[model samples]
Target: MNKITYGRQTISQDDIDEVVKALKSAAITQGEYVPAFENALKEYTGAKYAVAVSSGTAALHTVYAALGLKENDEIITCPNTFAATSNAALYLNAKPKFADINEENFLIDENKINKLITENTKIITPVHYAGLPCNMEEINRTAKSCNIKIVEDACHALGSSYNGSKIGNCIYSDGAVFSFHPVKHITTAEGGAVLTNDEEIYKKCLLFRSHGMEKVNFKHMPDSPTYHEMQFLGYNYRMTDIQAALGISQLKKIESFVKRRLEIADIYYNAFKGSSKIKMQKRYKDRLNSHHLFSVVFESNDLRDKVYYYLKENNIFTQIHYMPVNKHPYYENLGYNYKDTPLAYDFYRRELSLPVYPLLTDDEVYFVIEKINTVLKAL
Candidate 1:
């Protein structure tokens, strides 16, 4: 029996040809293709600048470093997401505070953010969970009044829109990050980019990714002109040209990829519409969910586990989007426990992500639906 992966990359012959062509070129690491890919992303998201990095976590760290987060500064974020969302703040020695999510969509609750804010709060990092954009309009207003910087963890939101504006447009937030992992909307094997409309942020992000050094320029033609200067402490987080080549090729089909994901999500939604066995996340009419992961919430944790194992027994793989960050041992040792974020834990307990990718066929989709229904009937 062929194993059905929970999520996988959809690669074509075109993608391979692009990689081979890049390898045949002179520069495979830092080269022309890197900047070209960044420019492409900038235009696609309507952001003034895009800085590509090694991974999504690297992108998040670059943004925090650009913001100058320090030990005394504090940042607020939701707990119902990947640890990278909060761990980035910790990298700066800045405190990571939790703001519980809304039960409906598992997104950061705008109303609850203010109460968590304090004098030390320097940043507000909002994660657009499951490719569904957060209420940026309200979140922006809150950040402005408090004089806190806004950084969106939009790792799952490529090609998604809120109120007719792209997620990385920087309309509501100061900046946003996108991940191009194999399982994301598009893949560059392992890459990410930071999008921003602010010029200062763009320069800082660039410098932070490349050893805090900038190439110095001289008008006079010297015999050998290779000059560079180190500005501040930074990291080697630069994305390679080979990965950027794949990124440019994959980007061309992003709209079609997201469209297919949405079509799959809709099928699952209609299939489980009025059942007491499971509940789907509510998609706001104004927001277009990119459908990075089509997760369903069971009535109880026990039922969620039963369905998960039953599907696994039949060679179908499923996963949980996340466990509450506060529940992790690292966070727990720091005094963050289940009691700290009630709603996040409740949401985590019922979570069950289904298989939804561009390459997932209708036959496979129907098989999943049938197996799920069978489990529900048996229970």
Candidate 2:
């Protein structure tokens, strides 16, 4: 059997041709394409401002700095996400406190988050895990009571929505970040962006992404007419025109990409609906999932391990969406005990992400389902 991947980027001639055109242009990095790409994303997500950056980690780091996180200042986030979501705060010498996740959707539990808030809590970073929106309404309510800032870690959610609104609208948060990695709903080769309506946060992220230098000339600066000033500490996190060009092209197809993913997810959902050994994540009908991943929970840790290895041996790629961040070696060294977030730790051991992407064919989907059924039968 041929090897099938759990996630992959679907690129086309349009993406290639756009990159070629960018390469031939006189300006590549500082060209008009960068702004054009930012505008395209803003239009798609309805955010007033968007700052494209080199990588998702850079986007998160920029937002963390923009929020004015200081040493020992704490940010609360879920454990069911990639490390970048929480490590962004750690990069600034700030603390990343863990909040348990709802076992149903694998998102930060609003009630758990409410209990974790303290005077040190500066921001509430919620991850829309597996393209499902978090309990944004409740999260927003709780954050308001505590006067904490909100920065959505929307890496897995490009076309997802909550309460009839888009994820990047910043309606319930101060800012939102999206990753354009190959496996994401859209691809920019390797890029990310931060979206916000607040002018201060937008300007902060824009300056922070590019070495804290304001390239646009300001009449207030007395030194020189065209000279730039490095006002704040920053990093080289700017995205190139090549990546921007690809991103613009990819954005045009996001809706179709999301549509196909949802279709595939439906197939998987129906296939395992009545299975005794597996259970599907609960999705609310009011919101539409981008279907970035199709995860299933097994009956036990032993069953999950057996099924995962069996699929791998059969050339069907399978993976765990995450291993609770608090349980990681580094976090463990920080004195984070596994007993703190019992629900999160329990979910992590049995959750599995199966193949679900826009590029996966119908035949391949059937093969994956068949193989899974076979493995379950034997077990």
Candidate 3:
């Protein structure tokens, strides 16, 4: 029996060929492929611009820094997401206020956001959990009312659509971030990107990713083309050309990759639908999920743990989507505990992510479904 993890990357020979070609090139660190990948993402997402970075965390940090988020500012985000969504705000010493999740979809409830807003609120970061887009229409309306900027944590959503528009189009937000981890919809080893329609924000992100340095294309001083200057303090968060090469290749097949994931998800959706003991993420008719994670909420923590361990015992590894960011030890030390976010706490207790990836075999898929059904029946 082969071990099956929650998610895995599907890299083809073409992906390797691209990386090899990039490696043989003269410039690997900052080369043409970097821009190629950025342009591919920009075109794919319908965003006016895209900035590739070292990691999703780097992307978020770059955006937060570019936005000039600093102390005395507050960013409202859900607790039911990765820490980086809110940590980007804390990185600048700004406060990250938690908004509880919607019970049905485990997404940030737009209605809850108004209660958390204050005069100091600067932005609202919404995480598109499990590739299921949050209610961006409502979120956009809420943010616009208070003049708060929106930064979508779209780490799990790549080839997904919302309201007939692509996820990274910035249709309802100022900017959006995507991760290329092995488990996400696509893989560039360790890379991420920020997409935006605003040119000023796009330029800011570009500067922030590369040590705040900009090559002087000074048309006024044709005499000094080599002159470069640091605009401000920044970090080395640039993605390598080698990674970009893989990104470009992988992106070429993203629609197909996402299609496969959704196909696998449909198996789980049908298998578990109408079950009294289990509930899957609710799907919306307005959009398609990238299906990065097919998480199911068991009726109780005990049953969820039982099935989780049972699957592992049978060589089928699983994972938890997340423990609420607020309950993490570091945040708890900062006076954020389970009590701070009730909905997130309740949601986490019953959640477990099953194997969901573009490459999962049909036999393995059916085995997982059978085992889950067996476990639930036993309970």
Candidate 4:
């Protein structure tokens, strides 16, 4: 059998054809495909507005900027996420105060949030870790009481649902972000989007996605077609029309992709149910995970390392979802302590992501489960 990866894109011929059409169009950078893709995302996720960007990081940066995150302001978030979650705050010169995770679900423990709140706290950025929605209703309440804005770092949770609403619906957030990286639920090669119900936030995000320039609400000229104004500092974060076309095509298959991922997750759950050494993430009755990753914690860090290498030796490539963000050397240089969130640090040591993409066949899924069980039992 061929080597299996932790996750990968499942590109069909339809996706390729759409990309080809986009390339053949007159404007590849600024074209109709971009808006069409954004509209498609809006329809899928039920967001009133969507802004497509170059990558997930761009989505985070743009949304944070649009929400008025500024120097020295504090944003509370989880440490058990990709660096981009915290890094975006750093980009704005805003401090990121991390809350610990609920080890049961690998999500930000909403209970820890209020304790971290300070006068400087301006935004609460909850990361939907491993596609599992955080306790948003509680988090939203906390933020509302503090008069803080909520922006969901939902890069791992495109198809996930919370309280019977889609993850990107912005029901509990000022805006929610999604990534379209190749390994994500859908692929635009490298793209992302911000979804929001707030019109002002939506307008600001649109500006931030393209250098903070606007043609309509001009400060200088009124009706000049050649006149545009740079309202604020922004970045060249716009997604290409080609990527948008691919995103449009991929969006159509998202439900099927998420379904397959859940099926694989169930298979893994059943296979490891009786294992004494494996601990799976907890599922909540109100949350539906997109299954972007199928991660498990082992009895010990040593056992996790052994299994990771064993799988690699058997031509099955697994991955560590992340090291606690505060544990990174750069974050350490900034005096951020990993031990501040003990659960997150501990989670980092034992977590391993198995193959869980849509294209992974049932046979491949079983092969992975069989190998993992064999190694765990032998160890």
TM-score per candidate, in order? 0.97, 0.97, 0.97, 0.98
Q: Tell me the TM-score of model 1.
A: 0.97
Task: Tell me the tens digit of each residue's lDDT in model 4 across 66-172.
Answer: 99999999999989999998899999999999999988888899999999999999999999888999899999999999899999999999999999999999999
The candidate that achieves the highest TM-score relative to the unseen native structure:
4
2 versus 4: better TM-score goes to: 4
Give one digit per residue, the lDDT tens place, for model 1 in 1-379.
4677678999999999999999999999989889999999998899999999999999999999998898979999999889998898889989899999888888988889999999999999999998999999999999999899999999999988999988999999888999999999989999999999999999999999999987754344446657666778999999999999999999999999999998999899999999987988888989999989897899999989988998999899999988988899999998887677898888888899999899998888888899889988987
Q: Which candidate is the best by lDDT?
A: 4
Q: Give the TM-score of candidate 2.
A: 0.97
lDDT of predicted model 1: 0.91
Q: Candidate 2's residue-wise lDDT over 1-379, tens digit each?
A: 5688889999999999999999999888978888999999899989999999998899999999998998999999988889898889989999999988887777888888877889999999999888998888888999999899999999999999988888898999999999999999999989999999999999999899888988775536666667887888999998999889999999999999999999999999999997888888887977778878888899999988988888888898888989888889998998887678888888888998999888898889999889888878887
Residue lDDT tens for model 3, 174-201 = 9999999989888899999999999889
Q: What is the C-alpha RMSD of each candidate to the true structure, in Å?
A: 2.0, 1.4, 1.5, 0.9
Model 2 alpha-carbon drift over 4 Å, by segment: 216-223
Model 3, stretches more than 4 Å misplaced? Answer: 217-224
lDDT of the candidates, in the order given? 0.91, 0.90, 0.91, 0.93
In terms of lDDT, the poorest run of 10 residues in model 1 is 216-225
Compared to the true structure, candidate 4 yields what TM-score? 0.98
